[model samples]
Target: MDLSYTERERAFRDELREWLAANPPGERPQGEEADYAWRRDWQRRLHEGGWAGVHWPVEYGGRGASLMETAIFFEELGRARAPLPANVLGLLLGGPTLMVWGTEEQKDRYLPPILSAQEIWCQGFSEPDAGSDLAALKTRARRDGDGWVVSGQKVWTSGAQFSKWCMLVARTDPDVPKHKGLTYFLMDMEQEAVQVRPLVQITGEADFNELFVEEARIPDENVIGGVGNGWKVALTTLMNERAGLGFFLQVRLRQLLDELVEQAAASGALDDPRVADRLGDLHVRTEILRLTAYRGLSAIEQYGQPGPEGSLVKWLWSDTNQMLTQLAADVVGPEALTAGRPWAYELLRARGNSIEGGTTEILKNIVAERVLGLPRAR
Candidate 1:
């Protein structure tokens, strides 16, 4: 309930801010590969400075920061306009999930590379047919002599092209129920059976991909949390996916708002009372998003589970981003719709905000049934 940071938290924030100040993230370059290489180099710098994966345990080559400190890490990154380290999915989702359900060997093999950005990781949980409903996924893994062979397709897989490993969930026992039949595996991406094809977004970026896995081999040692227990392991990844990164994203939204305001002022849109009113409303909403993100972290720390703010923040963020971009289109007019412009790109990219991570409709159901104790929408 307290919004002020404790002395220790403040000290932690101060140290990070000083480090970030000394090591500023310079301007990001053009082109996808160049941008990714730049981020990878930045991640390497963070690792060398011991800033990457700050939330992971010290034994795992991290700073062993508390949940609040981890939130601060993300907030500071966004505040500094630092691109999230190249291995964000690994740090935020894969490493934490492995800590929960991976074997000692698995941890020993994967954790170090994840922190150092040596071996990039991607997720393969969402198939075209079974994105929202994980249990319904048709990706199948069958027993072989000493491993399992996976064969199926996964869509919306970001970073797949450059990844070395995939946190994959497949149906290992089709005879049983859908959810119970699943198994999680650390499938190697370099194998011949795996194919990665980029999916171009409205912004003309191919940050997402389609993965065609045809009999891809995962050694028996890579089965995480044991076969038929994938749903639980996947939930760990999903929970981590939703938690700390909201801080960074909410901060980024604030940055975009500031830019929009400056642009509006330059374009004389500030003179229009209607434009001013919308910008004011959006600024208030973005601030609310920031506060609710903190609330969610506190709720989880205190109650051992997320409060209403968990799903609420994600849902609100998606809608707020969409709304903010629409207002940009209005204030900036023709230039906003012009191709190759930043505002035009943001306007188009905001369309995916509602669908990515988790859909707004699905998040609403989660809040209603799980947080509000309401009946199922079904």
Candidate 2:
């Protein structure tokens, strides 16, 4: 596959780089509220500069960038150390899913707000009982007049507290099979029926939340694609989550590895053969992850769908990130373990990387069954 950027692509990159240099993000504020506000303001700047929603179609107030250009946008943003826009869930997951499955009016009403960060979004798919096996989710929704009433608990919903809307999937019919009975809805998070509580992590940061819904109201028009079509629509969101976010994540992994390398070199730890060997191995893996992600992008551009490399890249990234963070503990020594330090927090956060999105075990299953054409795992 031709991996080199063409002249037009290089121009696109140059244009983006120039814009970023001129409009670099300000220093992040101290508290979570302030930091989120900072990111939201940055998204506003991006929107004003016509840089938001680079992957969205032009008709939907996006740049209509090609897949490669979109990848470049995320990579550059990560390299610049810019925080992802506040409505990342909306821009990456909600907007794309709606574009595919939303009615015309839905797109008109929702797409612009997401691009401009006027509204934040969160996901409500993973329940207490259902993590990887999403179809087995027990969140229930029942018909109520012209809308639906939903009740369930969703865990690990990042940015739930700040979100105005949720990409919710609930079982609407228990009589049918689990997968077939589900429906996708954009549930309003501002209502009294919804409660969001912070789920504190080992790092003492509440980057995620638990969503408790008690008869939350969702209009019939809010149903995406249609009732009993939630699985397909949800798949759209899931695929976008895996494929679109990889660019930023892979670049962040590279940046972290670079920091570790600098730390190792500063301490003369790189002189040790074992240390040098491991460092070299991590560097190689980081590049491989970046390359595999590009290869997946190429496949999507050429074939209209992502290749198996999507799963492999995430698996590689999570393992490599965990390895990189562990190496930091060796190179940075005590400071890496001290509370509140960057490396220390990273070490703890890296622990969940393998389990989030899709666990390593689950990814292996997808690779084996879909990519390798092997038998399904029971």
If scored against the real structure, what TM-score would every candidate get?
A: 0.98, 0.98
Q: Judging by lDDT against the true structure, name the best candidate.
A: 2
How many residue pairs collide in each prediction? 0, 0
- RMSD for each of the candidates: 1.1, 1.1
| lDDT tens per residue, model 2, 150-229 | 99999999999999999999999999989999999999999999999999997899999999999899999999999999
RMSD (Cα, Å) of model 2: 1.1
Compared with the true structure, what per-residue lDDT tens digits does model 1 show for residues 59-93? 99999998999999999999998998888999999
Q: Which stretches of candidate 1 lie over 4 Å from their true place?
A: none
For model 1, the run of ten residues with the poorest summed lDDT: 305-314
lDDT of 2 at 130: 97
Model 2 residue 144 CA deviation in Å? 1.2
